[model samples]
Target: MAVVPVRLLLLIVGVVAQYVGITPPNVHPPNEQLREQRGLERSLDLVLVTLRILLWSWAFIEGSILFALSGYCPPAFARPFLHLPTNLTSDPTELTPAFLTGIVLTLAGALLRVSCYRALGKHFTFQLSIRPTHALVTDGVYGIIRHPSYTGFMMHTVGYLFCVLDRQGPIVSVCTGLLDGSGTGHTTVTRVWACVWATGLYLIYALMFGRMNKEDEMLQKNIGEEWRAWVKRVPYRLLPGVY
Candidate 1:
């Protein structure tokens, strides 16, 4: 039977997970608390938010085009892009290690994020701000990692990258064009894109580190000993075994 490319399917699932985890009820900080954020913190928040929007928009558009091209008969609108690679469906039993890993991580991250939402309730916000009734949450996924949501976010980002990198699709094609203007599949372009993506991943980790520290400081000040004790009990921030 035919199916949408696994990577494309993964992309759709991941995006939906993000939307579900973040959209409803807003659950954001009040205007006063939001304004209290440090300049650098606010800048970082905006940058990350903007980056996600651009990246997800790009991924969805690219994935859609690739999906259309993957059909046994390419859509008339997609025919102009016929020069692109078109391996859409694959045997489930023969899935690549990277693809399987992406699927696992994406789902795991989504679940983790949802758990965090439940644990934090109204306290959760995309911004780093403490609400009037903000209380340090220690149960649920938080018991494992202080910043389970960040871990989830990292996992989702990395998983999506893995899914895209596992095969030649729009990312490869576009990066190739950007690298050498040939739009032809060039090995050098592939390697360059990998390096670029790795750099972006590092930036994400760095961003998370900053945000985590800021959050810890905010909570430590607001909640005092209780927050410190919870951190001591949990120990880890993003990863369980490592830091």
Candidate 2:
């Protein structure tokens, strides 16, 4: 069968998995509570969150642009080998077991990501600043992993890449594989560039987390030593025992 159907199938599987509790539940602080708080609800915090949202939105837009541009890109050297035989009837019967498996994985990944975002809600600001509304949430999904959302994000990215590869056939695999093989060459260089970009993103995230921790400390100073004890118990910021 066509790649689109395969992707859809995977997406459906993801949705099912999410409903079945395979994914973490939303655990971010409530928006109303954060808004009502005096320290975290500053005007500057709002602006920062807005800017972060815009930046992430731009990432989505850029992905769309790349997908559109792919139409014009020339086929890779291994295109012939990777190409699916078109002579087969374009019927549902053509849906291979592998394609179905891909569909399930993709769908599960997408659903997990969506659930994560929904759970994060207003707390999902992309800025490197902690607003007054910030709170140290450690219940729900947070109890299991400090940042289950990031885990979900990684899974979603993998699913996305799989979908793209499936749709584009083996040409993508050949090109990417070759690029991977040529050590420190152009492709490898590009991959490193991506890693640098990702590192920068993580650094920004770290800064934001640090800011939040500082805010938490400030609150503890006002609230008393009890808060500090709680922080000590948590240990990790993003990961559990590992971090």
lDDT of all predictions, in order shown? 0.67, 0.44
Estimate candidate 2's alpha-carbon lDDT, on a 0 to 1 scale.
0.44
Q: Write the per-residue lDDT of candidate 1 for residues 1-243, one digit (tens) a residue.
A: 144465566667766765554343345567887626654555665665665685677567666655665564357866666564333232221345775676677778878888887887877777777678877788888888899988887787677666656544455555555455444545775576678778867776776688888888888888999998998899999889898
Point to the candidate with the largest lDDT: 1
Worst 10 residues of 2 by lDDT: 86-95
User: How many clashes show up in model 2?
Assistant: 12
Distance (Å) between predicted and true CA of 147, model 2?
5.7
lDDT for each residue of candidate 2 in 208-240, tens digit (9 for 90 to 100): 455555555555755456556656666564457
